[model samples]
Target: MKKIEVVAAIIQHDDKTLCVQRGPAKFDYIHHKFEFPGGKVESGETGEQAIIRELQEELRLDISKADYFMTVDHTYPDFHITMHGYICPVESREIVLTEHIDAQWLSINELPQLDWAAADIPFVEKLMAE
Candidate 1:
């Protein structure tokens, strides 16, 4: 199976982490699934660059500082994906969402409150264990 490589920003503020729910714009089984804000790394772009670009486009926010977290590989019924997770620190709690249906600032303890995208579950588990 072919693999799709992506990057994600686990943007956190204080004790709250930023999570986004996919909008109707996404496809079946993918849409409405909760996830960190980010997207696929385009050709010629580094994973860091991709997350930075995706953040600007999706949330209209900037991540001035970020720390590498972990990489996870996941296979869904339809496709396989590799995700690079980063802990992105932003200057503001404000965001303007253009792609997602909804956004939330939830504590790590609340991470399991919503249904998450399959691939993101591993990272979530890793996060809470920290």
Candidate 2:
């Protein structure tokens, strides 16, 4: 089993949060599922750094700061993941979708309506509970 570490950003703009949809995947469980924007944490980079870099790379969106949130550990049939979540407030909702196939800005209450990646569901539940 391969274990991976990643970071995710709950990017808030005004009253909505950004949600990105994956294009496709080898596994049906995650294919086209919605997820917060972020990616694998590179060597020597903090969770914050990884998130900032990921957002910039994947969305062409720049974020000035990231506040620590919570972490979720999940295991899938093919891999295990330890994901760090962050609360990142952005001034603009504008983004260039370089990787994902779709993007939406939905309020916290409306988050659960979308089909989400398994690891990302915990984050959605937490946000909706707030």
Candidate 3:
């Protein structure tokens, strides 16, 4: 198995965290679950750079800064992924929604109600604790 690094942006505004519905391609693991907006960190790209670039490309907004939130190492049957999660406040409200089917900002208290990706459970717990 190969190691993959992913950057996830956990943007929060007015106590709501920005989440997106995973695309059809994610059926293997996440399926239709909701997740923080982000993606894989390409080779030679720093974690911060990956988050900034991914957010810009996926959401069409300029991310000012990404604050480190948590780092999680998750293993699946086929591969292992290390995710660097960040909480960044969005400067622009405009989102392109290129890959995801839907997006929304949900309150921390209501996070448990949403069907989230399995790996997101720990991150959401940390967010709720804060």
lDDT of 2 by residue, 11-67 (tens): 999999999999988989899999998999999999988998999999999999899
The lDDT per prediction is: 0.90, 0.95, 0.84
Q: How far is 10's C-alpha from truth in model 2 (Å)? A: 0.2
TM-score result, candidate 3: 0.92
Evaluated with lDDT, which candidate comes out highest?
2
Q: What would the per-residue lDDT of candidate 3 be over residues 1-130, giving only the tens digit for each residue?
A: 9888898999877667788988786347777789888889988999899999998888886788899999989887667888999989865556789878899878888888888887777899998898
lDDT of 3 at 126: 97
Backbone clash pairs for candidate 3 read none
Model 3's number of clashes is: 0
lDDT per residue (tens digit) for residues 53-127 in model 1: 999999999888768899999887777999999999776799998999899999999999888998899888998
Clashes within 3 Å, all models in order: 0, 0, 0
Model 2 stretches astray by more than 4 angstroms: none
- Candidate 1 regions exceeding 4 Å error are none
What are the RMSD figures for all models against the true structure? 1.3, 0.6, 1.4
**Residue 74 alpha-carbon offset, candidate 2, angstroms:** 0.4
